[model samples]
Target: MTQTVPTPAHLVRQRYRDPQPTEPAQWNEVLRVLHEHRSVRRYLADPVSDDTLRLLISAAQSAPTSSNLQVWSVVAVRDPRRKARLAALAGDQAHILQAPVLLVWTADFARLRQLADDHDAPLEGADYLESSYVGFIDAALAAQNAVVAAESLGLGTVYLGALRNHPENVAAELNLPAQVFAVFGLLVGHPDPAEDARVKPRLPQGAVLHHETYDLAVQRAHVAEYETRIAEFYAEQQLAHSWTERVLNRLGSVASLNGRHRLRASLENHGFRLK
Candidate 1:
């Protein structure tokens, strides 16, 4: 028997786990791909080709940049031994080792710094916190574009924020220079079919989409509603987790940061003045 294809309405419903899902006004393959995204934890050992990696980088470059500064770059790691060492530093996530390529995205000012040094330019603005934020934002936008591109090509990806857990170690492992910080890691490869990961539900539209003015007063109700919906989502996966509890636990204390709380010091060590 052939499997049934889900309608656009069904895909939208699956995204939010909505009991009363309505048909979207507009729908296309891009929308479908964006909505269907799920983090693949298990992957096949099949290697990603250099051509495909270049294509993904091209797609990433197409994403909008702030002021056209383009202060980001990526290091694609495929060496098994190097990946294993990185995996050890990054919370020992098996997926990091399993994936064919680990793309280490960086908030890089090194390129601009070189240009400035060569021309004797001041580059005082690069030392400010705002400039750092721009680099970080630009890197995130680029990586997200790569994620969409990879998924569109039937490849799987999962972001590894744990790369920041030991920033100094990861920087050393990647041989990154000063003014270049490893913002995060992205694993890319063919997904293992056995895992069969489902779409993780998100909060209700009203909870996040604030019209004109922000409505802090009504967010509590939205959270309550989302709790019940996501509880069922968790139960289906045999994972006894609460979204609220997870958030609190993940951000409740300095211990909870898992060593990322020292990120300011790490950034400073990496030559960001953060003035």
Candidate 2:
């Protein structure tokens, strides 16, 4: 038996939107699947089976967690009515309702807190700002693994960050208890061929990848180059907008957040002291 190795350069280029591409030194199905990822907004009506969902969660759980805390959980919403309500709360993303399943990944400490309470144990550490970061990071890592797993199985998935726009409503809809925050939603289903969502380009490697130390002096030039490269990508899709302009507008004002500006308040209301 023999195994093929993927070219590091090709992977790097795909991630960086480099105009000059090189042939991969080696290749395999896994690497191919990984590099081929794109967020799928439009989905076909085909259903994702229970077996596949289980496989996705298995892969998610397999991801590394800090201190073996495993402080993440996923709520799979299959009911159409419930999914619709969630979609409404989550910035009205239509695909969330269209997809067969919307997996709401959460940063969960409630389970551990319950266990600690059962034994009259103190979980003061879980209340710290550092611990909150751990929970969110752990959840993100696990969800990204599930995204890859879904893509490997020929399933399309998109992360709905907009779910946080109405975090309180989302939490209420999902019946999440205290210490369990809905990190984001992942919509999984068959991709609709008509949507024609292409691979969106990213910033050049020079902009993000720093050697041993960081350098801010070179950032302006890299961003300028990226503006041109990603422009072509957007043009192909018949969309018009400068990458910098989009990013700036998306975060330029608190209003652009579409209610996510209240995230800190929402988190506090959800029982995260953030102290």
Candidate 3:
């Protein structure tokens, strides 16, 4: 049986649901994988082997780190019981328990802190808010690299931002040391074909990609266009909410944060002096 190859234009059209889609100037395997990404929540019982996990981490480490500080680490959780506990802490997302592995990515300053303590040196810069941003950014970059690598390998993955809902609990559950903050969780496994997940449409390129100065006023028109395009995507998934309404509901109130409003205090408790 001949497999139908998706051209760059097809993928781009699927991504933005653009009415008049244009073919990409260039295309490659990496671009194809990136454009076809979809979060897989349902998974088979198949286990992700240790060898595969190591490969994913190697890909993650290949990502560019801020100043090469590489202030990131990942904890691979495969134990069913531990995953269950973490699922409980993270809004009880069943996917956490269903997936064979849950990789808890962390912004790690503890390694550098330990090095400084051994050398009897003061690391005052790490106390600054800039350093915190660096750590978070580095972790995100590394995790994205891992995601790309995982998708390229035909494995399914989904990010679990809800891991931050109870930061202290997650830290304790993972036995994390001071200065090592859990950035987020990534569930990796073989996707259940029964789930039938599809590529989620995104905002138009004009809405985000700016050449020079950012134009705030033009965003309204772009977003209006996006609403129409993304409505078809929502309808296919049987979703009733509009994109604007969904985002508004997500951030319109303090209650929408789901206890993340105390993140500052949680960071302080975890020894992150966000100065």
Candidate 4:
């Protein structure tokens, strides 16, 4: 039996779960990979080799940096013991231990600080709140590229934002130095086909793709529409949840942040002046 492979545009349209998907104006392997992204929660026990990890990092490094500072670093943790400990620290996400690799991406400024110290230079700029944004942005761009590359090679992945819940513990577990904060943990491994996680729906184009100026008045309407769409997705998984309710609960109170509400104090403790 022969199987037909989907084109890049088809994959892109599939991502949105678009009811009336249009043909893409452009197509490439990169687009194909980007569109096929789905956060896989279950994984096979297969290992991801060091050579492949190196390739993923190469792809990450190829991403553009803010002012070429490249204030980012990644720790590829394959040790099951270490991964299990990290998983425990990060909300006990089972996938972290199940996956062969947990790539801990960080917003690293320790290297630059050392360089400045060596040159007897004042690195006052790094203390500003803006610089923290730059580091976070740089790390995100790099991680996303790695995600795309992994998907292209038929790997599955999921982002563990819960790593921030107990930042201090995570930093200690990873042996991170001052000024190097774990942004997130990425679980990378072969997919468990039984999970069959489909592409999650997204807000419609009209909700985000503004013509020129931003419009806030119509946002409520768009969000309302998105709730209906995502509800169907949740129903298919036999889960009962509301998008609005979930979003509200996620951010309605500081207590819900799961220790992340103390991030400012945590950051200060870690040497990020964030002035």
lDDT, candidates in the order shown: 0.95, 0.89, 0.94, 0.89
| Model 1 residue 130 lDDT score | 99
RMSD of each: 0.8, 3.5, 0.9, 1.4
Which of 1 and 2 is ahead in TM-score?
1
Off by over 4 Å in 4: 7-12
Clashing pairs in 1: none
State model 4's lDDT: 0.89
Among all candidates shown, the one with the greatest lDDT: 1
Tens digits of per-residue lDDT for model 4 on 1-275?
89889976567557666566778887877777777789999999989998999999999999999999999999999998998888888888888889999999999999999999999999999999999989889999999999999999999999989999989998998899999998888888999999997888788777888777998887888888788788888899897879888889999999888889888888888999999
lDDT of 1 at 30: 97
- In model 1, the worst 10-residue window by lDDT is 232-241
State residue 76's C-alpha deviation in candidate 4, in Å. 1.1
lDDT of 1 by residue, 1-275 (tens): 99998889999999988999899999999999999999999999888999999999999999989999999999999999999999999888888888999999999999999999999999999999999999999999999999999999999999999999999999999999999999999999999999998899998888899999999888899899899988987998898879999999999999988999999999999999999
Higher lDDT: candidate 1 or 2?
1
Ranking by TM-score: 1, 3, 4, 2
TM-score of 4: 0.96
Question: In angstroms, what RMSD does candidate 3 have relative to the true structure?
Answer: 0.9
Worst 10 residues of 2 by lDDT: 3-12
Q: Any runs in candidate 2 off by more than 4 Å, and if so which?
A: 1-17
